[model samples]
Target: MMLSTDNHAPLRRTPLYGLHVSLGGKMVPFAGYDMPVQYPAGVLKEHLHTRASAGLFDVSHMGQIALRPKSGRVEDAARALERLVPQDILAIAPGRQRYAQFTNADGGILDDLMVANFGDHLFLVVNAARKDADEAHLRAHLSGDCVIDSLADRALIALQGPKAESALAKLCAAAPSMTFMDAGPHEVAGLPCFVSRSGYTGEDGFEISVPAGDAERLAKTLLENPDVMPIGLGARDSLRLEAGLCLYGHDIDTTTTPVEAALEWSVQKSRRTGGMRPGGFPGAEKILAHFDHGASRRRVGLRAEGRAPVREGALLFADATVGEPIGKVTSGGFGPSLNAPVAMGYVPTSQSALGTKLFAEVRSQRLPLQVAAMPFVKNTYKR
Candidate 1:
């Protein structure tokens, strides 16, 4: 994941900085924050541990905002937000959340986000690198109807794995009862927190947003659980990649639309053409047109035929022997769970079908790969 573009700025530290250092975390710059790339267990172990048991991640760097409607109705806030993203925000019930993207007027993505209906208000979590822009966008557009409160005094953490429920339930008794995408205020470890039963790792997990002052204590308490290990950005990236989740700057960006990124499922039918309230959002014209017709290129999974892992920015080709560049690998790395190299990239729609053969140029050598189904691993989200 490309954390930040400007490297000269001073790196900020999260509330868990001390905890990470104490745990022997290897610190690195990420999204203008001094974050841990991995702990003493290493990236491979952290990745496997998260898959086998549970892993705790410090994601406080991401931005969190609360949108309160002036009219004291969440539906009003949802309707106002509809002018920004294409998702069916009005359909989000209290204590539930949905995935969405902020698109530019040109029909390109600005940033992908998670929006949760918290009864009286809507909670939004945006990418760390794009938080400032997103906040400004919201303020510039919805200031008249909504009160945007940026929750900078809170810390965010994600606990993910098959054992996540049991581990979190030990501290937050109500954790087990919430199903996937459920989001609301809850008392966790006797501390007030905003809990969401969702994650980027494709595992059953909860993202807890707690007061910054109590974050360290909550992290330590969760770490006391035998199944939970401190994971860093390295494992977090691989986990999400293997799960087929898009990294904001890598897989999807200003140049890519939701349809081209294979995220059409997130654009609900309610917002598409012929829906009750349609074509009101930014880029709705071009985006919805892509829905009606089709995008020239599509994001597809690439399975390398050999053990060599193809990194990002590698140029793709149609034939192994001779051909011009056909596509490019946006996110590529070794999938620890699959024990093989997997990648996601954009290819011509004609070459995007499953089982279609393709080649990626790695170190001047063309390596064979094939278009494959995504989620390299099956998602274990709790329904």
Candidate 2:
């Protein structure tokens, strides 16, 4: 299991170690990796650069898991995958991808992941913090008909922001042909790689999976471009927050159903409503019910005009009535794109409507807040 916790804060190094140190990257322990928290340029500059230009993130520490044909047939393996997630796995076209979560017996998300079909195999990228547990969970439940392979030596990098395409085009112009949710094999920084036109940030970007040995070379080559800067975890959180994207273990967890997480779009209508394929995966009965009855505490956006930013675990109340704590702030931060403090969390359906007035307790003050629409900033998904 990639999640071995032998060293709680053990520092694992990626191939880009030397380059990061050379560039004055302030390294820290994150998900078992000696990661670059920020560079000499500073976190604010890095965040602004990514919003205006492009930023490259070395995320090789995340899990790269493969579910091979258990019954020796890719279709059969895909069918088995349906038992784990609510997505129409078999319907995925070659080079296409889908986002889903591993559900526990009670129908709560274990870990959110992106599953990509490469015609010949299924590739996945999971959170680094939950990599070990996620891999074990997948392996334990996988039908004996398939086998799981771990790409332990793989390095993943994300080139994100507005100018990502142009920066990447220097290496593989063919990447432009792929639409959102599409992935294709391509080379960048003179190394073999896989490029996906999908990211947690709402801006256009690509997630590249490369061999561990070549990650450093690729990172250096991309950084050589004046347009590319090294972004840190701080910016990553702010970017995803502005995108209204959920961060597993924070915005979602085993207790939060996908429906409540407002990720129903990931569950294809055809799969849920029953067309060519039927829903028989675990907790389908309960999950489908949410589709019909609607989730009670829904994940929604909150925009507080005040300068004070609400942090996680803050209790939320509806209007002046402080009833049962309606919900709590999951992920909150300052959005560079919005130029204001933004927050997102779960709130009762009664108080989830747009413009619904709510109060967030921050620093002993009842901060007046309102539920705002998600994507705190508009998305620029390049079709």
Candidate 3:
């Protein structure tokens, strides 16, 4: 599925573009910009380096949205957002982040976003491909006094891997203690930055939000650590896939609901089945039904045999069934850490059990696969 794009390609650069090229980055077109797909280190080496040490990524293509309400009642604005997403945004405390997806009237996902209540306004980081769609959706349905301000001048950077914390801790003005999924603004390298104890790689890391102009300087300062090296988009994709994280357009879309993606736990029961604060939001009925019953197609992890990787669009067949194909691969690649191929996709609920055997059609050959629990690689999230 192609992401909607405007007449103008809308390709823009982050402050780190020059720095990336200086480090011998292999640039590619991603989310409509000149982005580094891999550095001179290559995807394999970059992936291993990040798993072992620290990798700094320039993720400025992701959308940064701020909701400034007339009343400045952040909770009220959060309620407006909660009506759109599955996460408990209204009840989220300060200095915390919630991963949520916007659903349409039919309970299908429109876009996935990270909402942060920044005291005065509701902050969001949206997928680059879905930025326009997400912004329009928010603008059309927002409550009174809410205004959507897309922070185009802001840049986002992620420092991921095991040694990420110690490297960043040196620059932070104060020792900002953080748990997984936590977020706070801090002074880094004598410059103010919004630091979140979160990342897509399933590793312990932080996403730093800074002014666009300052991104290059801050990135340079952070990469001063011997353990820190410039990572790129190629490693990012493989890392997240190995960690069992979904990519928005590939793994989820308008027809994919939270329940089908195995994200039912993201919606709290209290808000789901109409607890104290009932879920009276859009697609609540469908979401609740899926919660009470379940979805027809459920996303699961599959461990494939041999060195061959089953990529997205590969049809899944349970026990060699011809007419009834279970599902298709969403994201799949060779996992360096596991030394085997890993893939994730949706399959019928009956066959979603662990150790269930299945077949993935790769070219003319059908490769045998075993249904396994997700996070094919162990998640090192600080939580």
Clashes of 1: 0
Candidate that beats the other on lDDT, 2 or 3, i.e. the better one? 3
Identify the leading candidate in terms of TM-score: 1
Q: Which portions of model 2 show Cα errors greater than 4 Å?
A: 1-9, 70-72, 320-324
Task: List model 2 lDDT by residue over 1-383, tens digit each.
Answer: 12234565557788788888988889877767888888988877888898889999887878998878845566777787888888888888878888988887777888889888877678888988888997787788784856888888888999988899888998887677777889867777667788899887788889999998888888888888999999877787788888899988889888988899999988888668555665677777778888888878899999996878888888888755556668899989787777888999899887789998889988767798899998888888888
TM-score of each: 0.99, 0.94, 0.95
Tens digit per residue, CA lDDT, model 1, 141-203 = 999999999999999999999999999998898898899999999999999999999999988
Runs in model 1 with CA error above 4 Å? 3-5
- For residues 263-359, what per-residue lDDT tens digits would candidate 3 score against the true structure? 8777877677757766667787887888889888899999996789999999999765465577899889888878889999989998899999999
Top of the candidates by lDDT: 1
Tell me the lDDT of model 3 at 240.
93
Better of 2 and 3 by TM-score: 3
lDDT of every model, 2 decimals: 0.95, 0.83, 0.85
In angstroms, the error of model 1 at 224 is 0.6
